[model samples]
Target: DAGITQSPRYKITETGRQVTLMCHQTWSHSYMFWYRQDLGHGLRLIYYSAAADITDKGEVPDGYVVSRSKTENFPLTLESATRSQTSVYFCASSDWGSRNEQFFGPGTRLTVL
Candidate 1:
């Protein structure tokens, strides 16, 4: 991928099944994030990491887990996928520069049944 990208761009899974969304970046930005976007709401943060091995929960972190073992990857997992967790997942990276603009990946569209 050129910059940031998510794997399994389209997924359909059943409830109680485990689902993991993958995010990768080529820029090696210090900050990475996972977000979910639904129909009526804005992009809600799931988790973020300032650097490798350093991560924190965001606004809506329930039913989700994240880890940054390497600088270029930040993956989000749902141990027991639920219907409520179905949404478009986005991966982003930023360097916290003067502008601090986040570069987003082509989102993953997940459907839970």
Candidate 2:
């Protein structure tokens, strides 16, 4: 949609290196989330922020970090990326109060070789 999208749609990285993926949205949504989707697997939550200065870790947050200091920008960073961290990262956002309808980004593909 016109709300959210990711960067570096495809990426290749080496082991034990840091990589950062960017996510941006047009609407000033309150809830932003990061998720990774593996082959033949469901979307796994990585991190999410309720608003500026408020963030929380999701199911799989190890080796990954996120910050939402801005209402329209939420970026995810992979520190010391490993082979296991090679996957497609998707960013989503939802309205603050309604807590309904999540818009997904195109996704960033990071490959750790």
lDDT of each: 0.94, 0.90
After TM-score superposition, the amount by which residue 36's alpha carbon in candidate 1 deviates from its true location, in angstroms, is: 0.3
Give per-residue CA lDDT, model 1, range 1-113, as digits (tens).
47998998999999999999999999989999999999899999999999999999999999999999999999999999999998999999999673779999999999999
lDDT string for model 2 (35-84, tens) is 99998878999999989889999999999988888989999998899999
Best by TM-score: 1
Q: Which number leads on lDDT?
A: 1
* Worst lDDT 10-window in candidate 1: 95-104
Q: Alpha carbon lDDT of residue 53, candidate 2? A: 82
